[model samples]
Target: MAAATPGLIGAARAQSARKTFVFVSGAFCGGWIWRPVSDRLEQGGHKVYAPSLTGLADRSHLLTKDINLDTHIADVVNLIKWESLENVCLVAWSYAGFVGSGALESVGDRVSSVVWLDAFVPTDGQRVADLAFEGFRKAIQMAADKGEAGVHGLAKIPPIVVAERDRAFAESKVTPHPVGTYLQPIKVSGALQKVAKKTYIRLPEFPQPHFDKALADCKGDKSWTTFELPDIGHMAMLDAPDRVSELILQAA
Candidate 1:
């Protein structure tokens, strides 16, 4: 006997109930970086949207000395509002985590959950620069000294620091990030306090002392989850797309 249409309709409804995944990439990256993960998600019968932040990838022209953390946050917040997205599962990578957190502050009710992919989690009043390691800061300074303009010294990223072969491959795929975004301090009030769920995807290669402290502070908060991807790097999606996709599905 043929199955009833009502049963099929019920299955469709269950699938449709899955929330959309919105990926906000870090500095120097764009939507293109998320292609692998997005493909996997789509294959899994889910919709994924990756928005390139200002001053990165194909949007390099948008980079200016004036564009700061607030500007980046507004970009994501506006996308969420303009698209009328509700219960969004936001995934942010690297520097985009700061941008994502600020956007969350702006649209707390709209975000169903947040996943930080080996990224920063700034306090209420902190700048991305504050989170940078001393070596990273020195690299920026050296790059600026080389006469690279627009605050971020985009042209100097290649030789400043040592990177593993895979990490370099991922980094080489993107354009320069804006200096303004790094310099500008983020302003996050009670936004994180209101978000229903938060998760952190820690990469083994990157040192986690700072993040570990942050997570410890929020431990037992009943709204946070932490997972470690020992085989991944800062750019887990690009370096290990399958594992990243699996983690994302698990988080969802």
Candidate 2:
């Protein structure tokens, strides 16, 4: 029984070591949106934390014009420091990519990998506003025209851009994100250039030829890898949780 005890202990240790803690940041979304994916990951013997940014989720009342991209970045950075989470797999979806990139700049060494899900990869001196679609710009402008103040004032999620079902879910769970976060320009330099690994999870339906070309250019450099989900839409996690979970696990 002594030898058998050692073998069982070793198996348990192996299982624990396989556990990867994931931090997911949603675009214009609260942590609640990650409930489904979090459930799947937890069931698979992993840990996941999805943080709701200020002015988002039940925290909508916290919305203010002063909340900018730096504020959101600081939120994630503080969470990592407070939790002392090392070797974390950070996943940024859509607009959260901007926030995630800032977080990466702050905690590059602590992150095991950075994954962008159908999101933007801003270059140096670029703002989230620079990446917005013309329609999105118009919508936000229209909202501002109505005399609504602050970032949360532009609370509109077009169904045509996101999957219909996911749009419904998002609409039900949606909260205002800070407009300042979108308006503030992100400043990147040599530090962010040194991140350990970067991966882009591309959604096939989004017609982003320039993004595809940029990602392709990075492929041969060994610092990046692009994974395409042909069957899924922009909201791959919601559209196909199983596959998204599987891919995340594999990446982990």
Q: Which candidate is the best by TM-score?
A: 2
* Candidate 2, superposed: residue stretches over 4 Å from native: 4-7, 141-167, 190-193
lDDT of 1 by residue, 59-163 (tens): 777766667778788889899999999888899887887888889877888888788877777887787767777776776566555645344324433321213
Clash list (residue pairs), candidate 1: none
Clash count list over all predictions: 0, 1
Clashing pairs in 2: 151-179
After superposition, the stretches of candidate 1 with alpha carbons farther than 4 Å from their true spots are: 1-3, 141-171, 218-220
What is the alpha-carbon lDDT of model 2 when measured against the actual structure? 0.71
- C-alpha local distance difference test of each model: 0.74, 0.71
